[model samples]
Target: MPDENTDSLRPPPPTGWRRRIARAPLLLFRAGLGPLLGRRLLLLHHTGRVSGQDRRVVLEVVAYEPDSPAWTVASGFGAGADWYRNLGADPKTVLQFGNRHHAVTARFLSAEDGAAIMEEYGARRPRTARRLCAFMGLPSDGSASALRRAGRAIPFVRLESDPPRRLESDPPRPFV
Candidate 1:
């Protein structure tokens, strides 16, 4: 939309106060208050590719399927983001949404699939979509084509979990 280089549009990883603010949600997830944030966000437990140490980050959910218990998330900061790259190195990981933790594996989606998902997300949440596009330095006009373009440029990951097993303490409800 901006005619600028796509790479230039991508934001660098946050630092200083911005990094601290961006990571604040992780504290909530760690404190078992993730449910308070609802299904719109999820906590990802990933491993550092080089360090081989566990890492955690909270990401926004772009699409979710209750039946398959899958959550689709976009790397708004582009593929260079540490979490995204780590997943590329090793897709097997864990995802925590709300109060439920799932043993999930990451599946990278095709550009076409990402386009479709972003379009659907824009339709469902126009304001949020526009904001996300703007944040990613994409067009924030909220048009289907613009959102689809943004989707194509960004990387999307689908976290698929094992078949749901009901636990005694867990309520009979779908995991978002």
Candidate 2:
């Protein structure tokens, strides 16, 4: 793994209008514009760990299980990200991919798993992997060791939805 003293992979989170601009896709997803991104991105709905308020963030999907309602995402901002922390506090959340929304349980992947996933993702999307690494301030060489280092520095989460078990007292939301 790279030394901890190394600069963060990506720039610090944006502020003011920049933050709002970054979040525009969240609004678009809620407004039903999700399909435009297809399986590349997912809208994660989670609760604020401190304020106890609902929050959502759009994350790039690292891998999507075709036969299952499971998706993997990476925190390009590393483990200290608010969304990542919130998910740690409460693993149960919602993930919206395109028009399909599913309630999922979050699981933090092990470093080895993250490394493997990153390698596969880099292999499948070499350009995206290089760009992502560059944005994160990591070397964009796309080498196995370089990818493993990037994976170790960033945090990866897998979201898996449970089999439906609707409650009689609760209403069900339509899922496209």
Question: Quick one: best TM-score, which candidate?
Answer: 1
Expressed as tens digits, the lDDT of each residue in 1-176 for candidate 2 is: 23345435368988999999888888889889999987888999999998999998999899989777799999877777899889999999888889988989999998788888988888999899989889888885989889887777667899998788879998878899
Q: Each prediction's Cα lDDT score?
A: 0.88, 0.85
Clashing pairs in 2: 9-136, 9-137, 10-136
Question: For candidate 1, lDDT tens digit of each residue in 29-132?
Answer: 99999999988999999999999999999999988899898999988878778999899999989989998889998999998898899999999999999998
Itemize residue pairs with steric clashes in candidate 1: none
**Model 2, stretches more than 4 Å misplaced?**
1-10, 166-176
CA RMSD of each candidate after superposition: 5.8, 4.5
* Model 1 weakest 10-residue run by lDDT: 1-10
lDDT of 2 at 143: 92
Runs of candidate 1 with Cα error greater than 4 angstroms are: 1-5, 164-176
